[model samples]
Target: MNQTKKYLVVGLGRSGVSAAEALLRYGAEVSVYDKKTQDEIEAPLVNYLKTQQVTCYLGTDPSDLGRYDAIVVSPGVPLDLPFLQKAKTLDVEIIGELELAYRLGKGNYIAITGTNGKTTTTTLVGEIFKNAKRKTAVVGNIGIAVTSTALVAQDDSWLVTECSSFQLETTEKFHPVVCALLNITPDHLDRHKTLENYAKAKAKVFKNQTEKDFFVVNYDDPVAYHLIQECRSTIIPFSRKSILEKGVFVKDNRIIVKDQSQNEIDICGVDELVIPGQHNLENALAACGIAYFCGISAEMISKTLREFQGVEHRLEFCAEVGGVRFVNDSKGTNPDASIKAIEAMKGNIVLIAGGYDKNSKFDEFIQAFDGKVKALVLLGATAPKIRETAERFGYQTIFDEKDMGECVKRSFSLAEPGDTVLLSPACASWDMYSSYEQRGKHFKSCVQELER
Candidate 1:
């Protein structure tokens, strides 16, 4: 936080750029480094940073680790990299864009983190905040870098941030007034290296939260709930299962928030929510818990839940052709997430899956089908592995396609009337696309083309 200290930003992505810009604006000496070359990473932000005379080390490693006071790393940059390890050895501070933003910004943050439903919950939280007439900004892994909004955040503002495990990993003194952990499942194991390590990263979201602050937790998830046992925050829980004496939960088809006195405030009916899936119901519960603890009205929370159309690429309806409906769930980039997507659909699904593997096992995902999935269409790097898993499970009706277009066409052909052509890849899209957004957009376009 010292204005005169020098800072280094690793990675040239959005978070990296925002961190670099924020440091410059804080009157600190700033430098940037990325494994990608200059031409490989270019945007108005990158060009603007160059105009600021910011030092950039592109397509190369930093030679000296001791020059900068701290390194602000992007979520994608591995902290175990050689130079980063060297920096750690020299006693240099290492933090992420989220930490930097927390230090620089002035706001009450409702930080949401989990293996799945983060985007949906964060979006719902933002909507609830907006409905309450609070000054709010939606940032972090929901797409906008938190640092980009850091300077403008006032003390009265609310930053409804979507914190990823990667962002949470580097947090130091990054505290949110309301922190929610939706659920933790096997995800990003390729980066974190283990499920418990991944859970540890998620557990950091509530690390700095004081008892005065509220920590929203998923009581139904044993893995996530166990980690919160040592948390210092005033715990607020939401569950799809047992009825709690306090916090938000569903009972008799209604979303209810109970106080210490066992008084309940009815939010809305479960069937009234615009988004689908039991997972989404959990997301709504978490959001409601966060908003209620933050002083948002039950009416506003219920209204927002009823009106939320859901974020794009997450169970989004694309088109219907020849009685076959197409759904885009590109955000289902892990097995646990795809399983939720599968459970949300109605009719028999001809599913298009497979992408970049994150060391995820597809056994649970495949088993979730339970005769609901009619056929499988595979693509991307994880295609072979997924196909093997599917065959071993006795779901042999599968077709391996070279690309998204072929996969979409094949899935549509395999679907009968009243069936859903669902693109719910249980792997990340890095092997075939820059991001899940790019992959989802491509799937939607291919489906739209079918109508043409």
Candidate 2:
């Protein structure tokens, strides 16, 4: 409860740097440390830290962390690290950057967390609030760090945060007035060690909430649904399969969002959603639930849904050339997500997939193919695995490449008129790219080069 707390920021990545800067602005003694050197933390804004008199210990000794009263860890850093253990022994409170931001934010929040669709739901909810003329800010894992946004929060503003399991893992007293726990899936298992652990991490968003808070959850998701039974907060359930008279539900193609008083509003029909796939319909449902609960009108919600442009790198259409439509869905990092992307495609598809395999089961992809995929263009470390799966499934047309450019060139070669060329890699892009953004940009670059 110190007014001018000494904060130690671990992991100088996007979240880490933003949190450090915010702490300094608040008159807190800020120091940062990371395993990487100054050159490795290549953010241009991080260089400004030195001018602001912020202490930086990049690629330095762990002993430096022992001096701070509290530690704000980056989401990427492992919770079981030796430095974290040392900090705990010394009674230094260790928390994530989101937790720090939550403590600083004066406005009420609508926090969204899940394995997938968090960004979509968060963005949609923010848009609804925006259309209603509410002062709202969308931050968290989607891009802008919450800490910086909180510093400029107004009395009428609302924080619509998209939190990841990594951010939720270290949260303390970061309760949202209205929390949305979207569908939980088997993702980031490499970091969480198990599916159960990942679910537990996501559930932490509502762990400390009181009766005044509300939790919006998907009743169709087993893990998420079961967790709701254990939550102390008031629960409002939603589903794509069932009809809920008192909560958000789908009935005859239209999404009906109902409150406790049985008052209802139809935001839009599933067929009207600009974004494709059943998963996106579900995302829209979750967003409508969040927006309606936050007091956004039905009219504004409908208008925003009609005008909302879908998130980039997730089943986004690039262009049509020579009657071949190109899609960039580099955000599909798991087999389930990839399956959804494929299911959303029209006509014959030349799929460009494969990256760093995390030992996920490709059986879903194999079964979902059902002759829809005209040709399979594989790349990165998981090319062999994808090829093996395709071969095992008796898929006749399969091509392997080392990188994105080769995959695009080969896919174009095999594609005919009315065929879709999709870059929906069901694996992490770390093998050949920095992140999914790089993978998506590279795919677009190759497609443009081919056009030229």
lDDT of 1 by residue, 79-152 (tens): 89999999999999999999999999888888999999999999989988998899999999999999988779
Q: Estimate each model's TM-score.
A: 0.98, 0.95
Candidate that scores best on lDDT: 1
What would the per-residue lDDT of candidate 2 be over residues 1-452, giving only the tens digit for each residue?
Answer: 46577888888778998898888878888888889887877666556878777787788746755678889999888888887898898888999988998787578888999877887888889888988988899999888888989878976779999999999999988988899988887878778889899899999999888888889999889889899867998888889999986778998889898888887777787778898888888888888878877778888888888788888899999988888999999989888888889998988999999998777768778788878898898998988888888788788688888778999999999999999999999998988887898999999999999889
Q: What's the lDDT for candidate 2? A: 0.86
Evaluated at residue 233, the lDDT of candidate 2 is: 88
**Backbone clashes in each candidate structure, one number apiece?**
0, 0
User: In model 2, which range of ten residues has the least summed lDDT?
Assistant: 60-69
User: Cα lDDT of all candidates, in order?
Assistant: 0.92, 0.86
RMSD of 2: 1.8
**RMSD (Å) per prediction:** 1.1, 1.8
